[model samples]
Target: MVELNEVFETNTMIRDENLDVRTITMGIGLLDCCDSDVDILCDNIYKKITAVAKDLVKIGDEIGIDYGIPIINKRISVTPISLVGASSCRTRNDFVKIAETLERAACNVGVNFLGGYSALVQKGMSAADRLLIESIPYALANTEHICSSVSLASTKTGIDMDAVKLMGRVIKETAEATKDRDSIGCAKLVVFCNPADDNPFMAGAFHGVTETDTVINVGVSGPGVVKNAISKVKGQNFEVLCETVKKTAFKVTRVGQLVAKEASRRLNVPFGIVDLSLAPTPAIGDSIADIIQEMGVEYVGAPGTTAALAILNDQVKKGGVMASSYVGGLSGAFIPVSEDRSMAYAAEIGALSIDKLEAMTCVCSVGLDMIPIPGDTPAETISGIIADEMAIGMVNQKTTAVRLIPVIGKKAGETVEFGGLLGNSTIMPVNKYGCKDFIDRGGRIPAPIHSFKN
Candidate 1:
């Protein structure tokens, strides 16, 4: 475990400030909750969750206070609802009820978010799955704390054009449904390609079938620590910045590994991966973009910002791997436009462009995240971006995902503030060129040549 009082010398690359882990999610496998009767299955799920997770918030708070490091969120992820409810849910209403139960369970425990109300129909969708997908807008808008996601592609089965189209429509409706609340409900939703099973982050986490019955995973976030490391060497050369990031990330991941193991031990659950993502908050001076800007750029999205981010991302992975044997999730620097204040500022000033953002995703954690587009942008355009990012991940055989917000009645350059953790961002323009023909191809883009290891 990381010693909180390890004092640092002024010249050391690593220094512990207010750095802390964001959330340590406990995923409880709910596949056994499946039943022939929808109501009975829902009842069983609520009972199981309530019984086991009743003390989640209390226990997490105790640990956080004891360690003097704030655990910002305590949450849970369950098996994808479509999989767990496959035997029970014959109609869309049944899925909605199940979603409601999940929401209520989270609220009962004071957990802020409950993920895995999702499906993994990367290649195709079953009828029940399709209905569940269609109902996301209503479910998310109406529920208080439910999050949803769908994996539309993987390195093995490739991208599913039809599922992508349906998800695009769902994204649009989800935005409209919560437009009154600045689309706050939409913030709880994520669309993924090559999603990770042990992710402790919000909006994209799920308990995959291969996971233990229950496991606790921690997501340690330290953008301020990383920014501090970069700022200390502002006038240094690029190589110096990379080395600084690697050394700082080593210390940061050490803290995460310690926190994760301790939390799991306290909970009496098996320890899971430590998601070493540089997840940002709306707080000023606490962003990955700020780190890049501190490294000599006038602002984020300047000429060398993407390259700098690439270096930071790589070094973080290298250092984190050395610190923990169980490093996983989207473990890198996240450049979500809305989540990072500097990223939003860059987009507002036109320093960041869609193409540049796409390139950044090639090296960073996820793709096209928290990006808002003009409401009128065609569904095909959304599918095009999804396809493009998924293609990159598939070809590279790494996890990449998109969590776009098609902000209704909002256009490029317009700023929308969702408030709180969702943060604020100026909308970005998408390519005007149409992709109707490509999207209409509407079949799996076969797994890349390199994916065939056998």
Candidate 2:
């Protein structure tokens, strides 16, 4: 049992340290709502989502009030639309209709964003998957609350070069469609390799086909809290630094554990897991980069940065896992450049670069996350980048994702403001050299030799 007294001690963390629950995501299964009739499918989906998530926002708010834990966003995830709408969807437009329906449900239920406008074709693509992936640009651009993701690779199934190549075009198209909004549609579209079924974070969350009918997963953010703890032991040895991060992570996860349990019990939905990722915000004093800097690195891309990130990520998992009964998702330190001000600044001044960011993802929770690059970045180049990240996740047997917004009409070194938690981004330069030849060799990368463990 968690010491209830420890929960009250978080008042300081909440008030001063920018500690808050990032999101309370309710994952609703929609397989039962699938239908051969497109209209019926859309209706069934909207009805099911609205009915199941009717009280989601209210309950989430109440939990925040009751526990003095500021729950920032209430969101939802559903079964991957490629599978859920397979019986009904024949064309790309049909999938767009479902995306519109999902937007309606999210608006009615008052959630900030609803995920699972997604496809899972890590090995190969079915006709439905192809249609869904093709429709992503329009689906995301037309809907404000709907987010889309496509899984292009996985550990067991190797990399799907076709999907990787396709997503490059899709991402570019999404940017073009939403160019007026600083290519924000691409902000809501992420491509993943080995995505988590119960991730409460956005841009890549989907209710897996393996999940129950309904579930609640919460992602907790406390970068400032951890940073403050580390600051207390300034000039301390490595042993003290690791212990501080671990102990702070334990307390932070307990807070999430308490909130998740309460939300589940109140809504009569099973509690899924607590994702104790030190997800940062645009606010000052709340940055994963700051935590790394505190550890020793002068800047994020400097030497020894990856080692610091590795220590922070591992210690967070070790301590967070022990605090909650079930700990899952991409639980570690998030390094989204846009969301974390320090990271964005690092890129702005050339203290960070795309190549260094790719290397850092080897130790971080998510890969190449929320990075905005030049508008003129070639689609094949984007595919090359995705292929590289997928290769890392494939060989490492871990979840990695890419949310690159090739900001339309924007040049490198320019800034685009997304505001809110999405924050501002300094458009980073992509490699000018073309990768069309490499990307055009369209065949899957086979799974690593060690994947035959079964």
Candidate 3:
């Protein structure tokens, strides 16, 4: 038997300093729930969800208390509702039923968010895909805890111009539906380019068909740990800062492995993968931007920020892979503007803009997360941002996404306070300059010139 202490301890002084696994998500595959009869399909989904996750919340609570760290959320991800509902639903009302059933099931089982209310049309939109996108505003307006996403592009295939245009329209409609409430419905939606199937993160995670049936994936978060590590360094030597981040990441990943093993054991579910992302809340001291600032940058969007993040992301993957046998998902750093206090503060103070955020996304885990734009920004402009972000992932061959909320009636620098985990944000300005020519070009940029390296 391996000694756990020997495995966890090394030259690093940091060893599980108030660390915790943030989420234990049950990825219940609902592909088998596709029956011709809508009612039968609904029943099958409900039964499977309850049966697999009956003791999920209880097990999570026990493990959390035992480890003396709070498990922030218990969640579920199902098969993409588009594919699962396609067989049973012939109309818009049928899609509504699917969304409502998912919402009710999650509330009944005490799951915070039920993901997989999504569609993947990175190549082209199906009739079913069109209907799914059309119903999002209504489904999100009606349901309580259902999240939706649309993956419009992928490196494997290429950009889908038609789907991108459709998603831009869908985003506008979703925002219009929830305009009175800080566009909260838009808050639940994510637009992705190269989204991962096993992502345990919220509002963007869905059960991609490539995933196994009912696996358990963990998302570990601790920007506080990373910031503390950098705070000890009195002066700026970029290399030293990188080493500190690497050593700190090793300890953080070790804690994640222990918590994940414990959670898997108690839930009776096989452990899937650990997402070593430094996810943040609106709370002070928990921001990834704060970690960068502590490393000697004036603010997160400064000149060296992207380079700093590139080193941090690479070092994190290096340490996390050494600590865990299976490390997956967006296992880097996350810098959601509204969700991270320091990032939001930077936007508020005029240190970070959409241009700078674009550059940072190349180095960070996800792109332009939880950013608020003016409600009247042209639909074309929103699509343009998506195209630009997707192009970065396509050229670099990595996962990149966008979750921009066009907060209705809000303008640049205006704060919108969302009183909970949804967080708050000051609306960031989009480029007044148009990308009409580039966006209208409408053809796949033919994978990177470097992708032919083979």
Against the true structure, what is every candidate's RMSD?
2.3, 1.1, 2.8
CA shift of 112, model 2, Å: 0.8
Worst 10 residues of 3 by lDDT: 9-18
Query: Which ranges in model 3 have alpha carbons more than 4 Å from their true place?
Result: 1-18, 436-445, 449-454
Q: List the residue pairs that clash in candidate 3.
A: none
Model 1 lDDT on a 0 to 1 scale: 0.84
How displaced is residue 30 in candidate 2, in Å?
0.3
Candidate 3, after superposition: displacement of residue 330 in Å?
A: 0.7
**Which candidate would rank higher by TM-score, 1 or 2?**
2
Please give the CA lDDT of all the candidate structures. Answer: 0.84, 0.93, 0.83
Q: In candidate 2, what are the lDDT values of residues 391-450, reduced to their tens digit?
A: 999999999999999999899999999889899979999888888998999979999998
Best by lDDT: 2
Candidate 1 colliding pairs, count? 0
Query: Compared to the true structure, candidate 3 yields what TM-score?
Result: 0.94
Which structure among the candidates has the greatest TM-score?
2
lDDT of 1 by residue, 290-363 (tens): 88888777887778877888888999998888989799888999888898888898899899988888888888
What ranges in model 1 sit over 4 Å off?
1-5, 8-18
